[model samples]
Every structure is written in C-alpha cells, then in structure tokens.
Target: MKVLIIEDEKELSKSIVEYLSEENYLCEVASTHKEAMKKIGIFNYDCILLDITLPDGNGLKLLEELTNENKQDGVIIISAKNSIDDKIKGLQLGADDYLTKPFHLSELTARIFSLIRRKQFNNANKIKQDELEIDLLAKTVVVNSNPVALTKKEFDLLIYFIGNKNRVLSKSTLAEHLSGDFADMLDNHDFVYAHVKNLKKKLSEAGCEPYLKTVYGTGYKWKG
Candidate 1:
C-alpha cells in the first residue's frame, strides 16, 4: 500500500520508513505541513502518518484539509504528545487511529495493517473474489484452490487493483502508488505496464477470472 509520513523528527521518520519499507509499503515523507499538503493534493495514499507537531503548522489542520476535501484516505496520528485531549481531537477530526511516540515499530506496523484492512479490505484478513483468495496477513494468493506464486510487486499490484476495484486507474497513478516519491524521478511508467501484464498473465494461468481490463489509451480497471 502507499503511505505518506508527515513527520519532522528526522531519525524517527527514517526509522519508520525503513521498517515500513521492509513490510513492502510504498512510503513518501514530508516534514512540513505545506509539503504534506502538496503531496496529498497531488496523489492519494492508502494511509497517512501525521505528527501533531510540524515545523510550519499543526498536523490537525492537515486532517481538516483532508476532511474538507472529502478525501477518504485513511489517517493515523503519530505524535509525541500523549495527551488524551490530543487523541480525542484527532479522532474527532477524522483520524482512523492514534499512536503515541516512542512506540514499537511492530505495533505501528500492525496498526497500519489494521487500518488499511479496515478501510480497503472490508476489515477482513482474508479476501476472496470468486475462485481467487488472498490472505492479507499471510501475504499469500490462491486461485481455484491452488497457490499462485507472484512476485512482491505483482502481489502489490493485485491488491491495489482489488482495493480500488471498478475504478479507472491511470498509469501515472499506478506509478505513484507503486513507487511513491521516486515515481517523479522515473522517466516513464513502463514499469506499471510490465508489472500489470505479468500479474494478468499469472492470474489467468492460475485459472483466475479476467477481472483486469485495459481501457484502451487510458489505464486499467478491476472489473469486479
């Protein structure tokens, strides 16, 4: 999944990125509120880790912007402040969860997973569509009661498609979702095509339905 980390603490942000990267999350960061706002305006993220404190402004304001825009991106407030009021305000504003600083990386990861599942996967660890089955926690995919081996990127592509099912996803959007900030530096989104092609081939070979559809000059859609 894609994530935006709006944190000013450099070391903490670095550590969080490193840990979440190992979990296969596409993460991008913004230390200030303006930077965070710009990124959120340009692309959608599956989850956002916002700190209560920023160099320019309060993170809660960012939450307000998101609410005002009616964006449904899942948000989790990660702040050094442990005040009950802060947590309450965050939840009141629109945060899905709150994590106090100095928390365990494993705990943060678990919370991120939980929030993503609840928001995107109907709060189920296992997702089943026809003969295809996906275990979010186990990170496995099965088709027609048989296992389907997919590379990490292919698996990510599958879930991304399913999470946003029935929506037309542009190649640039897929590129950003898969590569995060690095997508801007990449010359082209050929990788998006390559990965989606491989995923389609693998799923088709495994007897899965043709849920993936090409929209001509547009992009792809999961026609579920």
Candidate 2:
C-alpha cells in the first residue's frame, strides 16, 4: 500500500516511514502544506497521515481540497490536537480516522490496514473471485486451492489490479504505484511489463484464467 505522511516533524515522519516500510508499505513524506498539495495533486495514495498544523497551511484545508476533488484516498489525521472539536472537524472534512500524537506505531499500522480494507475490500480480510482467493492479512494468493508464490512487487501489482478491476491503468500509473516516492527517478516503465508478464504466467500456471488484458496502445486492464 502507498502512504503519504503530511507532517512537519522530521524525526516523527522518518520513524513512521521506517516502521511502515518494514511493514511492506511504500511511504512518501511532505513536510509543508505546499509539498503535500503538490504530491496529492500528482499521485493517489491508499492512505494519508495528516497533521493538523503545517508550516505553510492547515491540514484541515487540505482535507477540504480532497473532498472538493472527490478523491477516494483514505485519510487519517495524526495531529497533536486531541480536542473533540478538532477530531470532529477532521472527520467532518473526510478523514476516516484520527490518531493523536505519542501513539504506538503498531496501532497506527493497524488503523491503516483497517481503513484500506474497509475502503477497498469492504472490510474483508480475504477476497475471492472465481477460483482465485487472496488472503489480505497473510498477503498470499491461491488459485484452484493451490498456492501461487509471488514476489512482493508482483503481489502488490496483483492487488492493485484487482482493486481497480476493469479500469484501464496506464504504465505511468502502475509505475507510480509501485515506485512511490521514487517514481520520478524511474527512467522508464518497462519494469511494469516484466512484473505483469510474470504475474500472468504464475496465475495461469496455477490454473487461473487470464484476467489481465493489455489495452493495445493504452495500457492494461483487469477484466474481472
């Protein structure tokens, strides 16, 4: 999953990124409201950890912008402000959850997983489609009751495709999803082709129908 940490506290942001990265989440950090706005405008994240106070602007304003844009990214406000009004305001603005400062990273990780599951998979830990079964918590995929081993990047790619099934996903978008903050450093998206090819081969060998389709001049789509 991809996460955006909109925090001015450099040390806290670093710690969160390190911890979440260890948990298999790709993280990006934005220290100022301007930087956050720029990143949000360009990329879509699975979850956003927002701080109410920023150096350039208020985090609440950012929430308002997201609402106005009708963005579906799940947001969790990680603010020092623990007042009821602040929490209410953040929720009213569209934050899915609120976490006060000095909280446990494990708890934060759990909240992020819960929010993503609720938003993407209807709060289900396992997602089934035809003969394919995906265990979200275990991060495993099975076909015809047989396990299909996949690389971490391949697994992430499969989940992303399944989540946005039938939608035409461009190579740039896929690369961004996979590369996260380092997406800009990518010279080309040829790695996407390799991963998709390998994933398709694995699934097919595991007795799964081909659901991933190439869109000719466009990109690729999950036909499921």
Clashes of each: 0, 0
- Residue by residue across 1-224, what tens digits does model 2's lDDT show? 89999999999999999999988899999999999999999999999999999999999999999999999999999999989999999999999999999899999999999999999889999999999999999999999999999999999999899889999999989999999867789888899999999999999999999899999888899987
Task: Give me the runs in candidate 2 sitting further than 4 Å from their true place.
Answer: none
For each candidate in turn, the TM-score is 0.97, 0.98
lDDT of 1 at 194: 99
Candidate 1: tens digits of C-alpha lDDT, residues 1-224: 98899999999999999999999998899999999999999889999999999989999988998999999999999998999999999999999999998899999999999999999888999999999999999899999889999999999999999999999999999998888888899999999999999999999999999999999899999988
C-alpha displacement of 183 in model 1, angstroms? Answer: 2.0
Write down the worst ten-residue block by lDDT for model 1: 174-183
| Candidate 2 local Cα displacement, residue 28, angstroms | 0.5
- lDDT score of model 1? 0.94
